[model samples]
Target chain A: EAGVAQSPRYKIIEKRQSVAFWCNPISGHATLYWYQQILGQGPKLLIQFQNNGVVDDSQLPKDRFSAERLKGVDSTLKIQPAKLEDSAVYLCASSTGQVQETQYFGPGTRLLVL
Target chain B: AQSVTQPDIHITVSEGASLELRCNYSYGATPYLFWYVQSPGQGLQLLLKYFSGDTLVQGIKGFEAEFKRSQSSFNLRKPSVHWSDAAEYFCAVGGKTGANNLFFGTGTRLTVIP
Candidate 1:
């Protein structure tokens, strides 16, 4: 079976510019997630979506970051006015929507803000 | 609320040597524990998890983990490591409610010397 898919495996942007990342989850998976992994650190959950509805986004930087999973399958994470600190790998994952289910991840988009 | 700690930032082991990576966690209750591996330029892959019952759990890629409640730890182990085992390993704990957020430790990077 195919795993989660993400677009633009790498991206580069200047500070204060805007960038967006996309993810297409595994077919039939009901839960999707976005995470940020800074160098030498583990991936941190940015947001989670269960069938197009947000399940948790408390850690998300609402002022500069936003995510949406419309129609419950495809998701997009956007960062406006990017900062140097925002340079990291943005990972997308999907699961069966069951509580505490195993999550499958994508290759991730490596964003470098100069 | 919940957090994880990986004491060792990096470890080097000869190929075919036994390997152990430490993981410590702080939680209010029995946590949903997991181990994930991430290769360079790749996504995170599940290695194993411990929900309850058995303290020791077997996982893919000849990996295993033992949950020690007294120690508040779940450490990943491999009897014989291969060069392919060189990657960043993460230990995570899932919250109990409200989407059950997953908290990750700053991963342990493994290098296998042939």
Candidate 2:
């Protein structure tokens, strides 16, 4: 079966610029997530969506970051006025909604802010 | 708050040798644990996970992990390592709460020598 898919495997932008990342989850998957993985660190959960509704986004930077899963099959994460600290790999994952189900991940978009 | 800790930033092991990586977590209730492997430029793949019942869990690619409630640790192990096993390993924890969000560790990089 095909795994989660993401667009623009790599991106580069200047500080204060805006950037967006897209994710297409596995077929029939009910849950989707966005994570930020800094170099030499693990992926940090940025937001989660169950179908078209958000499940959790407490860690998301409300001032600069936003994400949406309008139709619930695909999602997009956006960062406006990017900062140097925002230079990290953004990973997308999907699961079947069970607590024990394994989450499938995408190659991720490596964002480099200058 | 839930958190995961991988004490070793990097480990190098000779092929055919045994391998072990340490992980610890802080949570008040029973936690869902997972081990994921990420090759360079690739997405994270699930190695194994532990929900409850058996403390020892077997995973793909001859990997296994044991959860110790007393020590609050979940360490990954392999009886014999292979060159292809070289990758970045991450440990993550999720609570039993309604949300399925995960908290990940900094990660451990594994290098296998021939």
Candidate 3:
């Protein structure tokens, strides 16, 4: 089976700029997730979706970050007016939508906000 | 609420030697735990997870972890480290319902020397 797919493997932009990352989860997977990994740190959950609705996004920076899984298949995460602190790797993952299921991840999109 | 702690920031071990990485969590009741490995510029891969049943769980790439409820710890272990075992390891905790979950640690960087 194909693994989760993320676009724009890397991106660099000046502060205050906007950037977006796209993700295509593995086929048949119904649960999608977005995570951010800063340097020297582990991935932190940003948002989670079950079908087309969001299940959790409490940790997401609502003022700057927004994500959506419109069709409940592919998803997108956007960062507006990116800050230097936003420089990190954005990872996408998918699961079989069952409780305690294993999550499969993508290659991730590295963002460098200058 | 759930939280994880990785006591070690970095660990260096000689190849072919035994390895163990420590993890601790804070939660009111039983928690679902997971270990993931991330290579440079790549996404995370599941090493293993503990929900119930077994205290010692085996994972991919010759990795294994033992869940100790008495100590509130889940540590990864390997009998013989391989060169490719070098990566960043993260420990996460989640809820039993599997929604709005996965609190991760800062992570531990592992380096294997030949």
Candidate 4:
């Protein structure tokens, strides 16, 4: 089976510029997630979507970051006015809606803000 | 709130040597624990997870982790390491609440010497 897919494996943007990352999850998966992994750190959950609805986004930076999964199969995460601190790998993952189910991840979009 | 901690930032081990990576968690209730490995320029892959019943869980790539409630620790171990095992390892904890979002630690980078 094909795994989760993401676009633009690498990205570079100037500070204060805007950037967007895309994710297409595994087939039939009901849950999707976006995470940020800074250098030398583990991935941190930025948002989660169950189908077309958001399940959690408490950690998301409301002022600069936003994400949507309109049809439940694909997702897009956007960061406006990007900062140097936002330089990180943005990872996307999907799971089968069970708390215990293992999540499948995609090759992340490595964003470097200069 | 839930959190995970990986004490080691980096570790070096010779091929065919036994390896152990430490993890600790802090949560109000019992948590679902996980270990994930990320190769350079790749996505995170599930190594193993522990939900209930078994304290020791075996995973792909000849990896295993033992969940210790008393110590609030889940350490990954490999009986015989391989050069391919060189990657970044993350420890995470998931709670029942909030869409089961995972809390992850600062990762542990493993370097295998042949």
Candidate 5:
């Protein structure tokens, strides 16, 4: 089976600019998640979706970061007014929905906010 | 709020040597724990997870983790290290509530020496 797919393997932009990353999850997977992985740190959950509806996004900086998973398939994450601290790898993953199922991940989009 | 901690920021192990990575979590109820590995420029891949029953859980790539409720620990282990195993590893804890939000650790970078 194909793994999760992410576009724009890398991106660089100056502060205050806007950037977006796209993701296509694994086939037949119901749960999709977006995570931000800063250098020297683990991936933090930015938002989670189940069939187009958001499950959780409490950690997201609503002032700048936003994400949407339309049609419950592919998803997009946007960062407006990007700051130096926004530099990180944006990862997308999907799971089979079984409580014990493992999550498959994409290659991720590494963003460098200057 | 739930949280996870990986005490080791980095670790080096010779190829074929045994390896162990420590993880600790803080949660009020039964936790769903997971270990993920990220290769350079890649997304985070699930290594394993622990929910309940049997304290030990097996995972992909010959990885396994043992969960100890008494100590609030879910440390990962490998019988032998391989060069291909070099990567960043993260430990995460998921809440059991209906939403099941995950909290991740800072991560541990593993270096495999020939």
Candidate 6:
């Protein structure tokens, strides 16, 4: 089976610029997630979606970050007015509905804000 | 609120040595725990997880984790470390409700000296 897929494995943008990343999850997964991993740190959940509806986004920077999974199969995370602190790897993952199911992750998009 | 803690930031050991990585979690209810490994230039891969029932869980790549409810810990271990095992490891706990969001620790970087 194919794993989660993400685009633009690497990205670089100037501070205050805008950037967007995309993810296509496993074919039948019902849950999707976005996470940020700063250098030398574990991934932090930014948002979660269950079938196109947001399940949690408490950690997302609503002021500058936005994400959507319109059709439930694909997602897009956007960051506007990016800051140097936003430089990190953005990872996308998907899982089946089973509460204990393991999550499958994508290669991630590495963003470097200069 | 739920959180995870990985006490060790980095560890180095000779190849073929036994390896242990510590993880601690804080949550009001029993947590669903997981250990994920990320190799350089790759996505996070599920090493193991503990939901309920058995405290010991086995996973791919000869990895295992033991969940200790009394200590609120889920530690990963391997009988013999391989050079390929050198990577970043993350400990995570999933919330009990509301989409089961995962809270992750800062991560541990392991180095296998050949």
lDDT of 2 by residue, A1-114 (tens): 899999899999999999999999999999999999999889998999999999889889989999999998999999998999999999999999876777899999999999
Candidate 5 stretches with Cα past 4 Å from truth are: A98-100
> Which lDDT values do the candidates have, in the order given?
0.93, 0.94, 0.91, 0.92, 0.88, 0.92
The better-scoring model by DockQ among 4 and 5 is 4
Q: What is the TM-score of chain A alone in each candidate?
A: 0.98, 0.98, 0.99, 0.98, 0.97, 0.98
C-alpha TM-score for every candidate: 0.98, 0.97, 0.96, 0.97, 0.93, 0.96
Which runs of model 6 end up more than 4 angstroms from their true locations? none
Where is model 2 more than 4 Å wrong at Cα?
none
Model 5 interface CAPRI class: medium
The sequence of per-residue lDDT tens digits that candidate 6 reaches over residues A28-68 is 99999999999988888899999999988999999999999
TM-score of chain A of 4: 0.98
C-alpha positional error of residue A38 in candidate 6 after TM-score superposition, expressed in Å: 1.2
Question: lDDT order of candidates, best first?
Answer: 2, 1, 4, 6, 3, 5
> For candidate 6, lDDT tens digit of each residue in B1-114?
898989999999999999999999998987888899999999999888877899999999999999998999999999999999999999999887622687889999999999
Query: Which TM-score value belongs to model 4?
Result: 0.97
What proportion of true contacts does candidate 5 retain? Answer: 0.67
- Model 4: per-residue Cα lDDT over B47-108, one tens digit each: 88888888999999999999999999999999999999999999999867532688889999
**Winner on TM-score (1 vs 4):** 1
Compared with the true structure, what per-residue lDDT tens digits does model 2 show for residues B1-114? Answer: 899999999999999999999999999898899999999999999999988899999999999999999999999999999999999999999855523777899999999999
For residue A90, model 4's alpha carbon misses the true position, in angstroms, by 0.3
- Provide a comma-separated list of chain B TM-scores, one per candidate: 0.97, 0.96, 0.96, 0.96, 0.95, 0.96
**Candidate 6 residue A71 C-alpha distance from true site, Å:** 1.4
Better of 1 and 6 by DockQ: 1
lDDT for A15 in candidate 4 is 100
